[model samples]
Target: MPMLGFLERLKFAQNFCKSTSLVSLILVIQSQLTLTIVPLHFSSSHILIKLSISALLLIIISGFSKCLKRLFGVSASAPALVLFNVLFVWGMHLFVIQKAIPSAANVGFNMECVLLMIGFFSILASDPGWVTDDCYGLEGAVGGTVSDAGRPCEALEVTAELSLSGGSFATRRIRYCKSCKRDIIGFDHHCPAFGNCIGKNNHPLFMVLLVGFLAVEIAYIVSSTQFTKESAIMGSALLETTLSGNLVVSTMLFSALQVLWQIVFLMWHVYCICFNIKTEEWINWKKYPEFQLPIQSQLGESYSEMAFINPYDKGISRNIMEFLSSTG
Candidate 1:
């Protein structure tokens, strides 16, 4: 009887872990899907808003660790988890529920959502840590760790002198980054997307990219909502109340899902902004003192206070730039 009881408890724990992991995975997929679908409506003004929000959120989340530690005395990881939950819920609604149904507008939305989900999740799951290259250099210089040839490497130490050069100074001996074909100051990895490394010099840009992604998604969701409403009104047939009712139901479901996803993402971004930290630094805080160091200490001269910038140029600026740059 004792043995059976123990076995049952163990099984329950294992199941719980599995369920939690699965849920997390699903949410990640949904968030990515929303991002992918958003691009389809690039022409819409809402896309710009969403992109802005995403970029802002990324910036906030990147800096969350410090805020939490100083203000609330909590781990930045806690807020990160919250943000992930928000993003997951929002993405599920936008991509899965909204796009799952068949309609002209919905079809486009769904396609974008599906693509976003697949692409985003693929990137997240692949765990492409800090990218390194000759242009950008190393990643997690301030504080983080990575596996090299089956061994763990410490994050680059940030010294006053090193900060000026945007390089890392670690106790561990310096090594060559094959991707960059040079001995990186901090020596992270090469991120192909940015054509640079995620070291001290480019961390700000990486944060910008993350925030941009979030903002774009939000804008897409808002604009799509308007289109969805118009579509339903036009397509509704009085004679077939059942069809109309179904359409309403589908819209409600999609809206609800989207709301949830946005809430989760918003919360997470809020936390990050308030705290001052990134996912990588949070994960390996103990291993690296760089993360443990105060934000004031880590910040370098190049670290601009205005890290978040609007991705798009508006008004006359945009018009003139487009006209001048476009090929006639």
Candidate 2:
């Protein structure tokens, strides 16, 4: 029995190491970059120790993701996405900022990281307005007047009205997330990549995460511009060379992709915030042209009517503030 127990433990450890392999590689490279470039003050042995600790931390962080998911009893759709964000941010710091620029953990950069980390974890772990009978005053009754509370229940309250095809109205207050197999109150779609529903509660935090990450990337790009070019004549040539190189090339490519996509994402979110509409609603409008508000007719006459009205849109400034607070 003791031998069997040891075998089981060995099996578990093997599985864990396999799971954390990619994360550990990224961490080790990131740590090495930090010591070699960021501070440039650590000895080789100390850098080696730092790399070892980073590997340990990767395992610990993987365990932490599991703990957070189970503790909240949520089956995250995108655990890997959260982990990737960690790697991406660290890559920017270690590969791009540390390598290209000379700033070594300055106060402004550290504070930006502080905000980024706070927002990242909050989105990964925070509740996104799950439907609950207990909170809605449905007594000791399990799944009374709605679906089951802690299971693959879909029945949620109907508070708002959505116009369906053929003039039908959807009055459900919450959204049924087929992905989460759970009822969500004011439920946004299940963003498996985000590992949470972009629901009423933590939607703002997720938006903040997007904005903060974008800001961080923008700041890094601005700071690293001087390092990216040696002279004006070799502008495109230098970039191409960086792409061919292993370390800086990969980092540069990653930075370019991130900067482009993050800018678009941040801008779209800003539009949503200004309109005081949920991302789900906006997505539906894009996919279904019928859902969009009818534009003014060419002759200033009435065209088709809008499918529904947004009650939350007070004004652009107010909507922005509301989203900032996530009260909506």
- True-structure RMSD, every candidate: 16.1, 13.1
Query: TM-scores of the models, in the given order?
Result: 0.30, 0.56
- TM-score winner: 2
lDDT of candidate 1 at residue 280, scale 0 to 100: 34
Predict model 2's lDDT versus the native. 0.52
Candidate 2 per-residue lDDT over residues 253-323, each given as its tens digit = 33445566678877876787788766666665443333455555567666655555565577999977765
Name the regions of candidate 1 deviating beyond 4 angstroms: 1-17, 21-104, 130-152, 165-328
| lDDT (Cα, tens digit) per residue for candidate 1, span 1-328 | 4465357446534543443445444443443443432233332335345455445434554365457457865432222233354455345445544553446655554455555444433332221222223222444444555546422332443333443454423422233445544343323345543333434333333444445445545544554455455455324454433332333333333334445555675555344333433333344444443333333335556552222211112454553443233211
**Whole-model lDDT values for every prediction:** 0.40, 0.52
Off by over 4 Å in 2: 1-92, 95-107, 135-156, 159-173, 230-246, 284-308, 325-328
Where is model 2 poorest over a 10-residue stretch in terms of lDDT? Answer: 35-44
